[model samples]
Target: MWKVVVVALAGLVLAGVGGVALAYPSLAATTCPGCYGLTELSPGVHVEDGLSPAQRERVGEVADQAARRVTAFYGGRRSSPGLLVCLTEACYRRIGGGQERGVAVLNRSVMLSPRGLDPVIASHEMSHVELHARLASSAEVPQWFDEGLAVVVSGDPRYLAPESAPDRCLVAPSGPLPVTLEEWLRTASADPATYARSACQVSRWLGENGGRAGLLGLVTRLNAGEPFSALVRTR
Candidate 1:
């Protein structure tokens, strides 16, 4: 079993990630020969050939819907045209050369598992894109918070189980909230509760102040070079 690796960045966030860049190989370059073809079902969505036209349309619909949903909640600063999404196991694995369920690149390119193009996954990946669009390349975002927000917004049920309060280290009174956002996320693993904890913390903060607007404000502050942990410091 592959442990998920997530990274939250200012302009390019990735789940099950290694790093940045949208340099996927062409569809014809997949390691699995003759296993993939590309189709443009919508202005900005490219799907692999295994899906029928109807399935491709549905995938595009899901992608568009997810983009709208995430941008609406996180703000519309996302200016990218759209994205490239893979829909086959061979294509997903071959494009990014990874076994992680999903991958999002800086150029708005996404490699999704065959069974992973549903609304939840669609929304989750788009969340990264929208948030990334709003972020600066140097912003400080915790991995847990990044993944949590995506999961909650996507309505992904697995991590929906409410997480108790965040760790004391995250919320307890401290001398200037420790700046561990980068290191924590860089090393985070596939702990289901970690996502829930992030969701809980961010959701709680938003709930306490403003909802979507609050989230947008946080993005703005982050873009301005303020660490998210500092801005949301409980004490």
Candidate 2:
């Protein structure tokens, strides 16, 4: 009877672990890309099984273009993170994606859903990967700065005016901009204009500062142990 009880307890523990893994499949993708049946199409690029050869080729092209764009914006080259493309919604959900067209998994990888296959979206996600890779820890970076910088780097027209100065507010925010990641996520979920607000603020800062040079200088300062608040104080 004791042996049976012990086995039952072990099964329960395993089941709990399995449940969590199922709910958050990104855990497996981040640590073990092979676990989800992804096929490597090229260096740092992986795709789910259902993508055709043509789709695979498209993914590679998009990834390359995104990398080039981000590199150009930074004025320096950084290694590209792993790119995981999911052609089907099932695959996207299996890899823990929801409404987001794409998501950057830490600084290691970016997962692209079917709708996220566009160059702009890919570049946007890659922007996150690039910034995160530059820092020892992203905890020091404000959520608005991170997200807004990604928008600027990607030139996402949805949030900014076309061919206009970065400081121009394309979409007005419904409320105050968020600072912390938690607050950013909450506001983003509730208000679609959060990205616009963030982009506007960062753009305004860039305009007042030295634009691209200023951004590079800020990153250099952050990397050299300067506090973000001190580097990015209100003028």
Candidate 3:
């Protein structure tokens, strides 16, 4: 089965949406070929999918939380709903979606194939959406911050069985070693289980020292072109 995975930025493949490479401008709602069904959640925010009621509700909750989180981070909320979740690959295909596992347009919704939509996975992917939006533009986010925070927001902070988490969240090859920021940026994608653990490890470190705010600060600084060596020591 086809599952989305993160590709290098140079390729324009969405990080989580199934891996079909496309130019960033092509991801807009009107332009997107795969427009699934749409359901308004809050005032402007709506989720687009063909999921059952229960599943739809799950999408709404995550989208709501993502909106709130982004507003808190960037000091403003989306006037128009900036969230989208697709359940079936058909929905993704309608938008001319790529093979990348998922894609988040900073300041907009996220698009992913419906083949794997667990509660944790949904939250995790939406966090990427929130991060993307809060940054106001995609260029502001780094892969480490984008992926790590996705792992943190996916659910209550705790580990689960391998079968329970998304496959891509699993640990990467270098996971046995003490992972550093450098390693996080350099490493390729992993299964959900490994991704979750890696996020946890980074989240744990952030919490032990600086909490989410601290982590955000560190990320922001790095994104501004500060060296990891400097931010890592300060954080």
lDDT of 3 by residue, 1-235 (tens): 1233333453454443434333342254523433335555555444564557897777667556655654554355333424455666666666545665555544345555564344455455556655544443323433554566566555434432232454333343243422454655345343334455555555555556566677567657656777655555312
Writing each residue's lDDT as its tens digit, candidate 1 over 40-128 gives 66666667766777877778777777777676766564655355566666766656536656656652555567777777777786677
Q: After superposition, how far is residue 222 of candidate 2 from its true place, in Å?
A: 2.1
Model 2 RMSD vs true structure: 3.9
Between candidates 2 and 3, the one scoring higher on lDDT is 2
Each prediction's total of clashing residue pairs, residues at least 3 apart in sequence or on different chains, is 0, 0, 42
TM-score of every prediction relative to native: 0.69, 0.84, 0.55
> In model 3, where do residues sit more than 4 Å from their true spots?
1-26, 30-58, 65-81, 98-102, 116-119, 132-142, 156-194, 219-225, 233-235
- Which runs of model 1 end up more than 4 angstroms from their true locations? 1-36, 75-77, 161-190
Rank ordering of all candidates by TM-score, starting from the highest: 2, 1, 3
Question: Model 2: which residue pairs collide?
Answer: none
By summed lDDT, the worst window of 10 consecutive residues in model 1 runs over 168-177
TM-score, candidate 3, is 0.55
Backbone clash total for model 2 is 0
